[model samples]
Target chain A: MNISIKRKDQGDHRFLVAVSGEIDVFTAPELQKGLLPLTEIRGGTLILDLNETRYMDSTALGVIVAALKSASRHQCSFSVTGMTPRIQRLFEITGLMELLKRVQTSRGVAND
Target chain B: METQEDESQLSEYRTLLAHYISQKDQKLPTEESEHLRRQLHACGILPEDLLGLHIEALKGAGIFSESAMMRSLNFLMKMMSGYSKAYREHQELKDWQKQLDTELDIASALQKTLLDGKVPACSFADIGAISEPAKRMSGDYYRIVNDGKRLVVTIADIVGKGIPAAMCMSMIKYAMDSLPENSQGAPSYILSLLNRVVERNVDTNMFITMFYGVYDPETGIFSNSSAGHEPGFYYSAREDRFMDLEARGLSLGLAREAEYKEYARRIYSGDMIFLLTDGVTEIRKDHDFIEREQIVALIRRWMHLPAAEIVKQVMRALKKMQDFSLQDDFTFIAIKF
Candidate 1:
């Protein structure tokens, strides 16, 4: 599957990464490469938007967890928004829902 | 220097130079050119100076007039650009290959440890199983649990292959081991418990097809349930016929309230139960899948042998038909009563 990543600077040490398509074995590496660097920025807020993601595997979940860990070590805030029900179910099943911060986006409001 | 003879010689030299340059093939230099340039630099001779001297020689020979010099310079520039682009692409490919190799090594190590679990021993039935992964990791898993009075057999195939499926299989093994002691003998109940665990622990995008069976030697009864797994075949020595042990259930991790129905059958001495993942039956010969009846026939032919030998012979036969390398993970279990 293909994974397209778009990075948006939200000003004041915050970044938004909108990821689309499937995050599977073939595509997780691309996603990891894009998100891991953002987590290293100190005291930054990294938001991952997965509203258009069609699917995610355990490896993808592992990558997300790694990003969260890196963010925590750098004293940065990390959250994921616009999770489809399928992706949300994956997070729940793998017990990663507790580790990852989930944000709700109402209409066109920015994910804070 | 002011001789007409010298001028005529220079003109002749220019004609000769142009003829040679036009006749020789022009090809872009490869990475070896970089090594040559480095060697030149180490020898106190700059590569740019070397090129400048050659250009001057060509100009003095009258082979490189203003337009000709520009054409040669442009060709050199394009050659350098092409070489650098090729070098970068080569390095990127090497890096990607190295990364994939490391990942496969880690995945293979993890899969080896999980697949090497001890097989349970039974007095009345002899069991043997083998799993061969198509890649560095496998999606197929099998476990045997003997609680002295009864034997529980489970064989499952996850949706995908490689590291992700291996991770899921490892989780399934742990979940199966953690089932309640009271739920050991009920095939349907054990599958239900396993389904719940998978639903809670595995990704929804992935699912597992499993066959869970519990055999009681004391009562000569075998109860089995499937979660979208292939139907195994049972050879009845008394009736001299083979029957499929069919059960209805959805694949695990499909839903929270998935239900599995169990089927029970009496076992007789000299009977054989054969179970396998799709890898065995799905073997492609020419363009069509190997017939299920062929698998059943093979089992029947080897029914008299020990379980281990039977499985070995069947695998040998499958390899003969499929050229010794399957496209997916191949797992098979044979139990002789």
Candidate 2:
């Protein structure tokens, strides 16, 4: 589990949480702990960066959904960027891709 | 008389062998053939019969007479040489086969030891972890340990497949064993320590993606660190949503003093936690890679079930999609908080 939580100093208060690796039953909790705290933070756009991610199972997909809900309660926006082809297909198949803004990289995001 | 009969059989067997040799363009020695002819002429049978007997023993030698043949030293020498060669070859083959089998046994045992089963602590109620190696030895390894305060569980995958990967897995196990027990604070620190241990020993070409965590039973809080392994999942029944817990960390052994961040979260009583290796993600269906939804559907379908049932259901889905034998090792560990 690799997670970096960055709060913007003076911008849109964007929270970029870059994650890579397989997210499944054993590892889901790690991401949950890392991201759940971000959800509690007052207001910031939560960006999940997953470019280096190689594989994701249902347990992992569930964590992202849970993180989204956690952030939503705080009125903080949540989205996934750097969707690998495998993960992108997963997001699309799970119907979450439509719900989140999928970007190739954090820099690739056209919207601030 | 018996010596005469033996000589006749010997000559006959020799003739057959000579014939076979001739067919294959090998010429018979004149003295040898002449001796065989003499043995047959002494008896009523043709020289061919004598030669055939010789071939049966496959040890044709000089002819034996009535008196001297009884003590036929020449015949004994021929028989000894022929029998010795054949027996030696057979013994050699058996020995070689035994040696090969021993090597395979050691490899198999190593594999089994690497994937040792966890007696799933009775406290968890339902917990299961399994790994299916595609070959003789699997590159996948998983462990569940009670950290007194929490259950520290992990599953790791070495990048390359087969024995090499399996060896790397062994290194991971040993490194994990060496880590300090139940240390509080960040799970990432433990992983960082393990990463240094793994890096110091493993080759630069090999890297491992691992999910290592300590889960507190009382707090339902789980802290974990990933090193280029896989994503994990958290299922929330109240919200009817499955969240993807994504953690980004540098792969272990990639660099010296590589820094890995730790992630922590609390799980409710109804929530479930799932972790797996890339083998699950790389599962194939109809000559195509299985998309994440098919996997989620498996979890969604089994959400109401127990932890073991959920793990089994997902495993079945992967098995069905595989159609053929899975090319990579498949490992899944599930724990319901």
Best by lDDT: 1
Quote model 2's iRMS: 13.4
lDDT of 2 by residue, B1-337 (tens): 9887686565555554445343433334547655554555545554345345544654443434443343333443332333455568979999999998888779879778766766457475357777787677777888887755668788787765667777878888877776665656466887788778876887534567777877777877777887766787777756777877677675565545656677888777777778887788777676577666667778788767777777877887788778748767888877776
Q: What is the C-alpha lDDT of each candidate?
A: 0.73, 0.66
Residue B260, candidate 1: Cα error in Å is 1.8
What docking tier does model 1 reach? Answer: incorrect
Off by over 4 Å in 1: A1-112, B1-81, B181-185
Q: Which residue segments of model 2 deviate by more than 4 Å?
A: A1-112, B1-98, B122-125
Clashes found in each candidate (C-alpha, N, C closer than 3 A): 0, 53
Look at candidate 1 and tell me the lDDT of residue A103: 19
